[model samples]
Target: MTRPTRVDDLPIRDELRGQHAYGAPQLDVPVRLNTNENPHPLPEALVARIAERVTEAARGLNRYPDRDAVELRTRLAEYLSRGGVPIAPAQVWAANGSNEVIQQLLQAFGGPGRLALGFDPSYSMHALISRGTGTAWLSGPRRADFTVDVEAARAALAEHRPHVVFLCSPNNPTGTAIEPETVLAVYEAAQAARPSLVVVDEAYVEFSHGRSLLELLDGRPNLVITRTMSKAFGAAGLRLGYLAADPAVVEALLLVRLPYHLSSVTQATALAALEHTDTLLGYVEQLKAERDRVAAALAALGLEVVPSDANFIQFGRFADADAAWRTLLDQGVLVRDNGLPGWLRVSIGTEAENDAFLAAVKSVDVVTKKEQQ
Candidate 1:
């Protein structure tokens, strides 16, 4: 039998014909911060408990894992409730990652004839997943500073009346968050046009200065809030993402999710992490301070830094962002050139790692690159 030599040799979906996969380039650099990951590792106590829990779960490998993920969802609800919004496990849903959670949402609420919309320069996955699920995507506008303009957003929602609307707080690449009023404005406009689902992607909310929007979920049945353990929980490898919404929304997702989609080992590992939530959260507080310090230092370097609410800062006005990005990579430092002209983003890392990144940038002649070009 002969193996296919190229992707074109096989029968692939028309939409996926020439599309590139979504991801930052994972390069081996001394200071890697391209992806917005928690730079800390799980504490030893948590690691040990994970081993113990997985051992217990291994005994049940013969049977299927819990299809509903009741315990995990219950714990997630409790975590969100600590922000002052009481939630029941029935109001929650879980998946492999927040990306999968978003995909499942598009599958359930968006389709071939449906439409989905998101503010531009936000999460790219919102559009990619919509296309994959056969939902038409609409790009909304944001201000030059990267904040969503209230009137502009309302107009877009009223005009499109998309089946699903995505709002990312502490939005990716820009690191700017949305105000509660903006959410309300968009939600009201969407309802005015048509009864639609408003999805607030709060994957980075755990690191923000203010409270979680979970409180808003109380009266807004059309709203959904998605969270993940990947960033603040420092469990990117664990791949556990969950959502809080009305019980009916949770029930709706069940129809679209694959049977036993989550593995027993993932459940065991995430449960162990939850047991150490306090210890893990301490690390988040420290990172928040570091993030602020990084922002100040970047400003001191004469770079324009966007005010960040997440564990990353977006800073640049470079003449050639791609050239500057290559310069950083040459210094054994890695940052993201998110293709937003003249801009780049750097994830907050450990103190030493951050120092190295700062030093690398200092060594590069920021003005010289533009002059050279």
Candidate 2:
């Protein structure tokens, strides 16, 4: 018998045999606007709080972390309730990251022989996680402008009747927010087709021009709203994400989550971050302003910039986006080529970082050279 030298030779899962693990390239560049990370480092006061909290938690490290993360959940609920929508602790759940929160949702409500649906060019993770959990994935339609066409979406929902539906408000790569009317419409269509679980991935909502859909969870048991601290909290390295849904929905996820899934250190750090939510949110306002500035500058340069509510701008109608991406990378600025036909996304950074990106764009003369080329 021949030795198994490649993945193809091994008895791998049929679906995963040729699949690539999903992620943007984490390049070591000077200006990394590629990954949509909060450019601000965690404030010093919060760092001190984290140290104090972790020291206390370390004393009890011999025991398993709060298997349920009850206190952490309670604080999270309080943090979310700042919107005037009361979120009870029981309605909140936590995991290592929003990616894990999504995975657990898929495990509980989606799996072998089931289907999950999302609009294309949205978060890629929705499809990848679905496949990883043995759930069939379906692509819904987005209009030329990247907004979901309500009628087409409803038709798809009725036809496919997916076990899970993902709606990414302030959608990744595009930075467009889904209107409440569209979400309501989609939820109704899903319910009519089947008792489906509709997940609204609000991972970037903290920097949005509009409010969160968390308030809508009151009457919609099938609805779920997932959030992350990575973006707004300036704690991306902390790896904490959570969701708000009906208690019953959270109860379903409980069955699929591993024991002690959240470490004591994570809980401590997240709790510390929550204590400084006010200060952290001040940074969000700054990013939101910078996002507007970047979008304006890109449009002024004659790039086709999609209107953004999130903390990034997707721009371009480049004849070869990869060329544009490579050009920027050469200038020590990195942005994402999200595989969209002629578009790329750049996360908003600090004032100086954003300035560097703009300078690079102007220096490259991307728009002017296109006509000459």
Candidate 3:
């Protein structure tokens, strides 16, 4: 029999030769919270609306989708303007997911001979996407609490003079939101160093306790804030993500975007979701409350809980995070061990699911109890 060729056998780029793909485990567990997904299903009303929209779109599937996704961009612009930022359709761009948004941004602003920087332990995809685009990746510094250290970040920006700087608000894994002051500092430093593109990944902003950083876009042409429907809209399956930036940035992205990148069905479904924005955001409020409840409950158990502005909570001082993750999994509850030593992240699920997860955590002895201060 002929041998099956291994991935290593293919002549792939040297940068990708040994790297693992970015993903959390997809195990079929009773209470799955590993992927930071919004646990709620779309409302029946919205489901019906999506069906109507998709059906309307189906009639024209023989033709290519809107190359610029005009109407979708207009609706997204209006939706963002509710944050008081007054965004225009010309300033918005949509893609498959925030991953694609990041990929496109890197393709345009970063590549061979250019470097991209993100704080250590923020989103892994920023670095991964940079590598895929052949852009050198640099890891900046963060405080022990997982907040970006302004001075350290500025120093790194000055030292590396990276062409692209990524800032993730309500960052993943740790669930820490970058302060507005820190974002401003980094943006200024990035520009001072090399007039770099500062992309803020706001994929979880809807669940934050603070206001959206959308207002910061004013006068900062180098700034970009990326968002996703996967979390707050409960539409991960829809694969819709977008960014709000200067009109010039949008124009630049046009140069790198695939022709008719968004499918008609995607645009139709996203428009349907936008029509029910208020309803979807109501779920965000519930998850915010549940997130706080989960954080407090974890603290009450003497486990260290990182303050989270996003829909997920990062808890534990587990001596062995992998073992703790497995223990939780053994109990029919799954959480993310984000390779951050002593920590694991759990998405805010429905109240009942959260209760089940807390119960499973209570059963485990792997959690290192936080010492009373």
lDDT of each: 0.90, 0.93, 0.92
* 1-373: candidate 1 lDDT, tens digit per residue: 8975777666976766787789899988899999999999889899999999999999999999998999998998888788778899999999999999999999899989999999989999999999999899999999999899889988888888899999999899788888998898999899998999999999898789887788888888899999999999999999999999999998899889999999999999998999999999999999999999999998898888999999999987887888888989999999999899888899999999999889888755555355657
Model 3, 219-245: lDDT tens digits are 999999999999999999999999999
- Give me the overall lDDT of model 3: 0.92
Candidate 3, residue 247: the lDDT equals: 96
Give per-model TM-scores.
0.97, 0.97, 0.97
- By lDDT, the better pick of 1 and 2 is 2
* Candidate 3: pairs in clash: none
Candidate 1, superposed: residue stretches over 4 Å from native? 1-10, 368-373
In candidate 2, what are the lDDT values of residues 1-373, reduced to their tens digit?
9775988778987887888888888999899999999999998999999999999999999999999999999999999999999999999999999999999999999999999999988999999999999999999999999999999999999998999999999999899999999999999999999999999999999989899999789989999999999999988899999999999999999999999999999999999999999999999999999999988898888778999888899988777788888889999999999899878899999999999999988855555466548
Candidate 3, residue 76: Cα displacement in angstroms equals: 0.4
Number of the candidate with higher lDDT, 2 or 3 = 2
The numbered model that scores best in lDDT is 2
Clash count for each candidate, listed in order shown: 1, 0, 0
